[model samples]
Target: MTVVLLLCIITSQLTVVLSSAGNFWTYKGSLGADHWHLDYPHCGGIRQSPIDLQTRDVVVDQTYLSPLVFSGYDRVSNLFFRLENNGHTVQVGLNDKTMMISGGGLGATFVAEQFHFHWGAVDERGSEHSVNGRHFPMEMHIVHFNKKYGNFSSSVGKVDGLAVLGFFFEIGRFNEHFQEIIDHFGEIQFKNQHININSIPMIDLMPARLTNYYRYHGSLTTPPCFESVTWTIFNETIEIAEEQLVEFRTTIFENDKSDGGVFMDISDDYRPVQCMFRRRLYASHPSLKYDMASPRENGNDGVSNQPTRLLFSMFLVCIWCILPFFSF
Candidate 1:
């Protein structure tokens, strides 16, 4: 191992790049190293930002409970995103398997509690953090709750009970799976009222690479951007065509209904990058036995690491907005 590598291992702070080529990590953001306040209630002592991962501590964890199932789901109109009345918080219903993450140590379990997103102007990059100084078109956050913490209500005020995973969205081919959310984009409240639909399953809203990603600690990109979350970013990014991007912009209501589109509303939803602050980033690079690691999982295993678990990207933004959701 190299000198820096040994230091990282000794200090227990290391970050490794997945690679120069990947179907994953397309979600990496394009952000500047402007500023981040640790004392700010939004991101203080416990707050952490996106950190790269290296090959050291990664194992297949399948026995642990994962909350990305077809639980009960809710359907609410997104018209609220465009109105000028200071806008309301994103609405949510429920599902069978969705859960949240908790800071409960390395082997702790986290469930899907809620999901949300942050975007920016259609003209600029929308992700909150950048990778090697690169940004994507959009980013998704799949927030989870540590079962030990409590539900959405009990956990919000406290940090000990939650962990959030973020994924970047870039422009590419069309995504048929995302159409479900796109179809419902117009229902959210734009004026005084909109429609609320039935609950949906969590399985349908995720990318194919559920087990592949690089995880770390970070803060909420939105205001009151809490510093409580266990961020897991997938190496792969989902693809969306130009027309779909345009449709997304139009369907999503913005401050100016006549001008800018939905993309405009979410385009600038990103917050600036935060400081590394000397925190260590852990990585699971598999056993280092495989030639090229899986593009969609944190790392792959051969034998002893049976019952391998898949790393899922909480793709609940864009279509869902304040609420957790995926895109079309």
Candidate 2:
């Protein structure tokens, strides 16, 4: 019995060490965005993403920021999509080669790779990038890689390698197209879980108009925070029912079932707005205006001010380091 207990203790200790080490970054706690820079130097770089788009400072560029041309986005295919819960967010892989985008000042054609969402715990806030410091309930990012680089992985580090189309969500009537996605969430409720979705035209998930938008050079919001994305945030917001928003907040878990079956909700999977520095934010249309009188203007900019729990994390590390010494 003593031998069995010792073996069990060692196994538990190893599990704790591996879990802590493997998950080096997370949305909150000591390993959150504020501490990501310690491991990924680019997270601290000047060109980081999810900036508060202050409309008052935007530069109107209707000339070069022409209307984006989307090809094959509306085409319904027989190819199924893989929807997954990657622990960070729910992502849908769009492997179709036909789906492509160009124009809107993009020098080369870009092909769709995948799309994912970032949402808050409630309907009031969730979006990564806010307009005039006002956050929407949710945000969807359709990621595309520049065709010049050949594939998504190859284009990740290139300056002009990726273009991400961002759309905000507001509470309103039910969205049938969005429902198609939500219906599959049950299959991917746990981290690393995935399901195959029937083919649906990608256009169904987009806003009605794409002419009005904000553009800027930015980085991926996630860790290894590569400063390679050309961001296009739409002026129009997608409407979904309040219940649907709740479904998103409640349905997914960041932890797998095998990890003690702990229920950790995957909401608020977004990084706070980074400093814009000297970067220029551009608008496709001159008429796209924002309300300067937004509540966020009063200084509740939605950026988290919570101090990093570094000391606590170090204490846990020390415990893990000493666990092996306790064994025979």
Candidate 3:
């Protein structure tokens, strides 16, 4: 009888130890980004994301770059989305439809999966991808998977299998596009709370200029930092009132408040910019001449008038051929 009781006690102890070892990740402390690589190997990969987009360092290859094409971003005819507070951020899952992206220089078509945001406690900094090391109030990422790969799960770990569109938002005019989302925040204040929303025009959530953007090859900012994504960041920014931005902070990072775990705020939940590793950053618009001595703000008038060296050489050859023919 004594031996049987001891065996039962040992089994219970081992079960508790194994269960605690598989705890999910959080934004701070033990399970934070710094230690994510310990459990998820890809988190320490070479080509990570949320990189700084230095205007001068980026190569302006307008020849290969093209305007981003969206098929059914409006989705007026569909009521297919559910909002969820997934501990890290507020995510909106979309139902499969005509909503997809094909162009914008993407080699293949990618269907929308979901969208989420990264924000800060204060307006000084929040965005993941910074322009010239400047952070915005918040950032939105629309995630998509290459249709060639079938679904998001199968597309992971493959090259060019994902496309993520990023947009920066600053405090300005009230964004009517975000009102519906803000009003529903109360229902999802805790983690894992999800509710269906009648309608959402996903395109309206993006910046006005879809053609003017930056592109690069990088990994997902969150674990397991899979390096299968093609990133598209718009030069134009969207706007949201300060009041609406604050509502995002109310969401908790803890899965359950009654579990006696420390409560962490979801603000400043963005990852820091990773190393570029000499990777080529391409822009769709004309190149901006680098002053080197003085950095200039990349305002609306930043496009260069000077033609590319390759284009100029081709023009010269055409002129020479025409001159020789006329002389003969």
| Candidate achieving higher lDDT, 1 or 3 | 3
Query: Tens digits of per-residue lDDT for model 2 on 38-85?
Result: 667677777889998888668999999999999999998888899999
Model 1 / residue 105 / CA error / Å: 7.1
| lDDT over C-alpha atoms for residue 41 of model 3 | 65
lDDT of 3 by residue, 66-126 (tens): 8878998876755658898888998998875558999767989999999999998999898
Highest lDDT: give the candidate number. Answer: 2
What TM-score does prediction 1 earn?
0.57
**Which candidate do you rate higher for TM-score, 1 or 2?**
2
Q: Which ranges in model 1 have alpha carbons more than 4 Å from their true place?
A: 1-40, 44-106, 189-194, 254-266, 286-328
Q: What is every candidate's alpha-carbon RMSD to the true fold?
A: 15.7, 12.7, 17.7
Candidate 1, 129: how far from true, in Å?
Answer: 2.7
- Per-residue lDDT over 1-328 for candidate 1, one digit per residue giving the tens place of the 0 to 100 score: 2333444444333223322322111122422121222113343333545442333333333333232332232333232222121232233333333333333232455666555545555735766666645667666666666666656556554655556666777777777755654566666524223344444444455566645555556665543456666666665666776666665455454343444454223335455554454554443334321323334353534222221221112233333464444444
Model 3: lDDT to the true structure: 0.79
Cα-based TM-score, every candidate: 0.57, 0.82, 0.80
Question: In model 2, what lDDT does residue 255 have?
Answer: 91
